[model samples]
Target chain A: MLTPLFEAVRPIPAIALVPVAILLFPADEQGIVFITFAAAFFPIMVSTRHAVRALPTLWEDAVRTLGGGRRHVLWHVVLPGILPGVFGGLSVGMGVSWICVISAEMISGELGVGYRTWMSYTIVDYPAVIVGMLTIGLLGWLTSAAVELAGRRVTRWLPRAEEAS
Target chain B: MTLGITLESLSLGYARGPVLNGIDLTIRPGEVLVIVGASGSGKSTLLRALAGLLPAHGGRALAGDEEITGASRERAMVFQDDGLLPWRTVRRNVELPLRLRGLPRGERKAVAREWLARVGLEGHEDRLPRELSGGMRQRVQLARALAGAPRAVLMDEPFGALDAQTRAGMQALLLDVLRDTRATVVFVTHDVDEALLLADRVVVLGHGGIRTIVDVPGPRDPAADRTALRAQILEEL
Candidate 1:
């Protein structure tokens, strides 16, 4: 039911929502957070939906025959089955969120990497700008790595085909 | 605690069209009834109706006194694909039905381990389904099905995907396990030899309904001469 609305709003880039976030929130900090969240939310939601739909009906039937009800199917089969796909989405979302957050900070912020980078640009401090850019890249890489590590830990039951060697 | 299954003119099909039309059969308590047919002959469809996974298109299917309106723990199904939860460990997969039944965690664990040992899958409980061989995975599926002590077991070519050697081993293991449980077994297979080896009564499904029902003279006897009987079943197919 929410697909239509989600589809309509998804195409509007999260970075472009800076003015709207500024108007909606009382502080720039809240606006920046909102923009970051918005950037992350769509990828996660779309991937999760696809994951749920792609699950085999056989699993649900197996659970049902074993006397499991709707709630049991949801918890046992659906949630765990979608973990790998959800993690894929989370990784993408983390990357996208970093881009949006940095952009939002540069557009409207008193402090942070994006602001510092923009400030260095105005003052012709080329080395400081390079440091800020490097910091942003580092932070983005770390967050994505964290998500992937968590994903592997949770879905450890998945067979690691390459590990056999 | 085994349950007798009666199909009173049961007609099964999908939204496209009917498969089996107005079929009447009685699967006795503790009896092994093997359904054999060519492809698209509705053997699996009939078993699904008994398992309550598929609704009867025109008639009713009864498990003991109650009508089989939907799936129940009393009738557990084992699929050709094993149907073990991919993300769960072997032990956890076997414990699923017990967990669904609200069994306490410790008791569920103990019972799961016992079932796994019975299927000769001990010491591999912590492994995932993907880590196991096809034969071992099928054993896990069997363990999971019987863990709850269901009154009836509906199998849809459970060993059909296995190689000949592994299939024979699984058949022997199944006979050994069936000796312990009195559950009525409705097994579907395309192999006439397998049907003869396991079935007390062989149900030949063809041309949209049951073609014939043959009673094996002596079931589960590997040394028994079954050439004539095999020929008769093949003729029906």
Candidate 2:
């Protein structure tokens, strides 16, 4: 049910929804939150669903035949099976959310790097704007890196596909 | 604790229609029964039914006197896909059934180590499934199916992915493991030679039913006799 809704919204950039969020939410905080949520939610949900669907039926059968109960299957099989995909989505979502959040903040906010960058531009403080841009870039890279690190830790058993060569 | 299996006029199907029917079969304790058929002949359906992985549309599946309404830990399965949890190391995959049975961590680790070594995977136990070759992964799967010391093991094309030489080696390894464990085995494969090599009795399936049951003369038949049996089975097909 939610899959269809996400599929519909997946193609549209969350930044594009900023205008609708501003109109719907009374507070700037709420609008920014909504934009960020929109940016993050779809990728995570879609990838998770895809992971579950892509799982081979043979895996479940193997678990069941081994006398694993429903709870056991979920704990041992399904949860571990989807972790890599979930982490992948999370990393993507973090990047996307930072993009949308900064855009929303820049358009209308009193604080944050985005707001400061826009404010400096208005005052012709070009170096300050460059500093703000650098700051946002640094923050986005750090957050994404953190997500990647978590992904690596959780999915340690996964073969390093990128390092196969 | 070896177990015999009995199927009584079992029928199974998907939403569309019946896939296999009238499967009244018995596998003696410690017996290896290989089901062989053409692709899409519902051999897998029959194997799954016997393993209690499929719902019976009609009739019954039993592990001895116990009615098998669903999969049980007593009847472990080695799937064609290997079914190794990609997130788990080889040892963890082998120890999976032990974990499901609620064995304590130390004992589980010990059992997993023992089985991995038995399967010639002692040093490779820490590797993930994807890091191993197809044959190595299959050996892990075999260890996993038997590691928990289940009474019966169900196999679906267990060695179908291997090269001829590797498949031969695996067949030998499988025989050795089963000899030691005495677990009732029901193996499904399309390869006639594989069925003859591994089975006490080969069940030839056609049109969703058992066409014939061919008894192999010995554990490892001579090459000439093996060829003869293969030709005969091919004729039956």
TM-score of each: 0.98, 0.90
RMSD in order of candidates? 1.1, 2.7
Give candidate 2 regions above 4 Å deviation.
A1-34, A159-162, B219-231
Which has the greatest lDDT?
1
In the range B11-79, model 1's lDDT, one tens digit per residue, is: 999999999999999999999999999999998888888888898889899999999999999999999
TM-score of chain B of 2: 0.96
Candidate 2: DockQ? Answer: 0.68
Q: Quote the positional error of residue B78 for candidate 2 in Å.
A: 0.9
Provide the global lDDT of candidate 1 against the true structure: 0.93
Q: Which stretches of candidate 1 lie over 4 Å from their true place?
A: none
Q: Each candidate: fraction of true contacts kept?
A: 0.83, 0.91
- Which digits, one per residue and each the tens of the lDDT, describe model 2 over residues B88-183? 889999888998888999999999999988889989988888889899999999999998789999899988889998898898899888889999
Q: What DockQ, on C-alphas, does every prediction get? A: 0.81, 0.68
